[model samples]
Target: MKSKYYIITIVNVITMTIICFYFYEQNKLIEVTTNNDTRPIELLKKIVIDSNDKSAYNELRDAYLNEQYHEEVLFYSLLMANITHYRQAYFDFYYLLKYADRSQEMKIFDNETRLLMIEYLKKGAALKHEQSMHELGDLYMEGKYVPKDTILGKKLINSIGL
Candidate 1:
């Protein structure tokens, strides 16, 4: 029947649309982290063997940064923070997350990423990291990601003598 053929055509169109959307998203992520440079294979192998290896993380982050692969650098920074709880790594990761592109995973992690970034700032503040305290205070004042707590923000600012 003509109706049956029409239904099949509609189904095919929908399937094609889904396939196109998938490839489009993949292409977008690649475009966001575009690079013709080679990956640090040896460092990656070292990281695989020892996730807590700060040396490998530093090397990887530096290499990616030198190649202008900011997203990769951000990933390495986050890993360093998670692995070693380094104060500066936490700060770097938090700031980097702010400017991160939403070309990742259908953008589902955008809000989640912001929440994680706020948590990093909070940790950095707890560690008495001055820059983190200053930045978190401003974030609280502006309510950029966390809930607006002007009192807490002022206290943080004062604590840092800023």
Candidate 2:
């Protein structure tokens, strides 16, 4: 009847809208990947398994180049926090705090990354990472991120050797 037709039409419209929204998000993520020339995390994983693979690197670069603004910002932010690259765990912790949550699925590298950061901080207080020392100093002064330990903060800053 007329009522049934109206309901059907509304359901179809809603379904189409949902589909459109999904594609829009996909395009946005892809656009972000391209603009920054960052490879999608998936592609980056392949390159990790094959360090000398130029093709993988090229794919990564291409994806970044095609990425959108927001995606690039997020990508670079994560890149900066990469423990293997920076080893300054505090920066990663603070940086991740912006977007991370318990419900999020753990990436393959997440555990190792966190462990390395913790180890680096504990062993040498991020000796080569200037920002870590600064953060440590701030944490000591503020007693917010870390326990109040002025002596430890001073020693960490000095250890950075910056």
Candidate 3:
């Protein structure tokens, strides 16, 4: 009986230690801070350089957006969108459309690019992405690319439980 208790106690200690280590690692990943010695952008850039860390990529995206770095926003947004970060991707595309005038400047915002962007939104919507559904619905309702369909827009918004 004493041996059994000792073994159980040892096992519990090991388990607790493992749990603590796991939480520590997770917290480390999430604890991004701007300190006097390190700028937030520099840390963000380091995180982005690693590239496999999605959370860091998201932080970088937000940072770029806050700074009005349109091109960087587009780049990170596209990356996030491709990886199923649908809402961020949709908003980024929306921002580009609403502000950048990339099409006019580069002579590329023709029918093809518009259609492509619409398709991207549709893909996200198909995945039950809320912003994509909302944006696509709005576009449909406004007849931005296709015929106006208020019903579809309402349905999309409704699906979001909003």
Candidate 4:
């Protein structure tokens, strides 16, 4: 009778440990699925369907930023700008201007787009984005986008220790 009781207790302990470990692993799997299931293109389509979804915009922005999607970053930045989401707009625009090629292939080099890019760059510079400040300073020094303002350009460059 004593031996049977001991065997039963040992079996119960093993079963409980296995059950606890199984549940813990299931919880981890759920967490991973939740993190990885959100796709950027799907979020973009959702944004297109309902442009007022702020959370979707934020999620798409974060996802695309993580993926290093430059054109999508520019698109979302401009969209945010149109909605007056200035902080996110500035961040996204700064990244786009800092990393993207402003040629025809990127479809962002037209005169109007160039002006818009400069506008966002100036706003980003005002927010103290170092790269935007540097790029805008270079543009001003070279008269590439806005009218030449060498004084402001030099001022910006000096501010960044470059």
Lowest-lDDT window of 10 residues in candidate 3? 29-38
Off by over 4 Å in 2: 1-29, 33-45, 48-90, 98-124
Alpha carbon lDDT of each predicted model? 0.64, 0.45, 0.60, 0.60
| lDDT string, candidate 2, 1-162, tens digits | 989756754554354335435544565434233334445655663453345343443454345434422233233323333323434323433333323433358643343333433333443344455665666665676665357888877776676663
* Top candidate by lDDT: 1
Model 1: colliding residue pairs: none
Predicted structure 4, TM vs. truth:
0.51
Candidate 1: worst-modelled 10 consecutive residues by lDDT:
28-37
TM-score on alpha carbons, each prediction: 0.57, 0.38, 0.61, 0.51
Q: Which candidate would rank higher by TM-score, 3 or 4?
A: 3
Estimate, for each residue in 29-94, the C-alpha lDDT of model 1 and write its tens digit. 332211333445454535733776765555555555565555555555655676688777678677
Q: Write the per-residue lDDT of candidate 3 for residues 45-162, one digit (tens) a residue.
A: 5665456456666666665556555555555555556555556565665556546555465644555445545655776788787877787778877887867899998898888887
- For model 1, the superposed segments whose C-alpha errors exceed 4 Å read 1-67, 101-109
Q: Residue 63 of candidate 3: its Cα lDDT?
A: 58
